[model samples]
Target: MKILVTDPEGYVGSLVVACFTQQGHEVISVSQANAGAALSLIQLAVTDLQNFDAVIHTGEICGTQALHPQIAGNLHYRDAMHLANLAKAAGVSRFIYLSSCSVYGAGEEEYVTEESPVRPQTPSATCKAAIESDLLTIASAEFSPTILRPAIAFGASPRIRFDVVLNNMAGLAWTANKINIPGKGLSWCPVVHVLDICQIINCILQAPRPLVHQQIFNVGDTNHNYQLIEIAAMVAEVFQVENFSFGHHGFGDRGLFMTFDKIHQFFPDFQCGWNPRQGAEQLLNFFTLTDSIQSHFTLTRSPYHRSENHLFHTVSIA
Candidate 1:
């Protein structure tokens, strides 16, 4: 199938691009340097949208640094809605949007389902929830829009991210010879491997229109959920960081415990191949092979940081 994947150079986007290409799908990538100009450019790019069967949109400004609601809301929420319309205008049948489970927020609830109420507290998550709501409105018999709210994703990517929970812990463990939990380590955190996320997307792409149309699937296994301390223990085992401790006051115990039964029931063949231990091992191997082990796992060139820097440099040059 012919596919259009946005932000192909991003952490998640790069993985989706590689996975789709390896699966023999014809994938076209799109990136508008100016987030503010995305809507206009996408609307004008009629020739670029020709003959694509589906679109997987992974483009958006997101990070710890993207804390401002106004800026993030405009870039992710507004731009996303516009992109959805662009997909429909381009005659694309299937639109797959990558939403985050972070929209569920840091609730005391024991479990979060796709049906759970979203009380997004952060600007990033608020934007994600808003985008999901708007995207559902655009779904139709002809335009089958599917939203996958993936858990905190980990695993090596062409454009790897150490900002996520597990990866961050792994980085600290490898570098600092210790893993520290800022708060009590009981806060629940769910995780999914990057490859598993690709598999979920592939399923959505292949599934019948009736099955996935307007569907929201929390994309991870129930078993994959782990407490922050549990995660620290796993990282400690991998990096052999004996100095693992908890009970710092600054960080509170805000957790996300999501259930994946919806996606599991829909695609029975789907399975998360990488557990925390296995994923940690893969990361360790990656660090060793890339000579990052000696470099103290310091990434001199982070993809997200570089993208922002490049945009600034380009704008300055212009």
Candidate 2:
């Protein structure tokens, strides 16, 4: 398999590149600069420059995504739209669009299926949903465009983001000695480990024609959904923070739990190796090690202090 990936420097993109290479697939990781091996010289977006065995557009635009729509979310809308067009024109064999579970909207409702009426309330999620319809049109007899909507994705990345639930818990527990909760602490958050995300990407790529062609599968494990407090408690236990405290920020909020029955049914052997504990623990360890070094005398005098703060603090979007 010759895989061409855009945004190859990103967390998930890098992982996908690694997955393809480790599996003995010839991989060409393209950024905005260099196109792939066979791409010759064309340009608009990275995808526009390459034709390969497959194209997985995992490029991202990040900011806080919530109920209300935002202008920043439109960034992804424009970027992904161009990306999809470029991939299609490049004559890629398979195209996979990395979407978020938030397309299902946020709530505590259990087992939201693929057909369960997409309710994209937030700006970012809304953009994804809008472009997805276009992607589905490309899923006809000629091309197979697979859409994978994953819940909160966690793992090690060149860009480690702690704003996500599990990683945030680990950050605060290690730094502030607390895991903040705003409401009943029972709102469900569906989570998927970064590795499982990689495994499923391979599964989708290698799958037989009729099975995955032009399909949308919600990727997750049986433990996909978890109550907020339960996840926090587990993270605390993982880090041995037996007495971590909680503070509420918002109220009367609910979240939707996702259904993975469809993907599970298709890839029966797909196993999620990392749970909330593993993810939290991994985050905690990273934070601890980094913090330990930063707290030292010589290191404290360096430029890394503010860099560390940038990692933990949510900068107000200007």
Candidate 3:
């Protein structure tokens, strides 16, 4: 199959490109500068998309603060709509949109399913919800659009990030030898390995058209749901750190418990390959191997890091 993948240089995008290429599929990778520029480029490059089997959109601006002015000012909604239009104009058969579970927002609800009413509180989630709704309307017999709402992803990427919950705790344990547990660590959260999400994307693309057409799948396993303190304990164990201190930081107290039954029913073969223990160990090994434990702390300490101090901090909000 021939595939057109956007944001190939990004963490998940790069993994998607590599995964498809390894499976003997032709892949066209492109970078979307912004909504307006991306639309113009797509028009100019329309002829190149002929006979393409699918388009995987994985481009969006992300940050630690969703309500931050800069994040709210991003063109993700426009960009995603334009990408869907591009696929339609180019006669592409499939469109895969990588969305986030944050669309459910924060509430006292114990569990969130795909059928849960989306209450997007932040501009980022609002944009994602808008894109998902628009793309579903574009789905037709010939054009299959699949929306994937993945849980907070962890594990190593080509573009490694330590701003996420498990990774951040592990990094702190390995670097500063101290783990900061924000809040009471009792809030529920769902996490998935980056590679597992990539595999789920690939499966959705390869599944029977009728099975996934216009379907929304929450990606991750139910067994992977965890709390903040549980993640911290796993990190400490993985790093073999006996002495760890915890403090209450005002950030990352909110949590969303996402359900994954839809994804499991759709792709029974898909399994979460890594748990918190494995993911924490992976981060610890990567940091130790690169001798970048200190680097992780340094970069994540200030304005350079864009990841929110939570489980669902970094991801493509397509």
Candidate RMSDs in order: 6.5, 4.5, 5.2
Instruction: Rate residue 51 of model 2 by lDDT.
Output: 51
- Candidate 3 wrong stretches, greater than 4 Å: 33-44, 64-74, 242-254, 292-318
Candidate 2 structure quality by residue, lDDT tens digits, 8-98: 6565777888778888998876553243233321245544445577878774545334433465556556666666666667676688888
Name the better of 2 and 3 by lDDT.
3
What lDDT score is found at residue 45 in candidate 1?
59
lDDT of each: 0.75, 0.69, 0.75
Error of 1 at 72 (Å): 2.5
**Candidate 1 structure quality by residue, lDDT tens digits, 85-111:** 877887888989898887887755778
Give the top-scoring candidate (TM-score): 1
For candidate 2, report its TM-score.
Answer: 0.83
Screening candidate 2 with a backbone cut-off below 3 angstroms (N, C-alpha, C), the clashing residue pairs are: 107-255, 107-256, 108-255
Shift of residue 296 alpha carbon in model 2, Å: 9.8
**Residue 99 error, candidate 1, Å:** 0.5
For candidate 2, what is the total of clashing residue pairs?
3
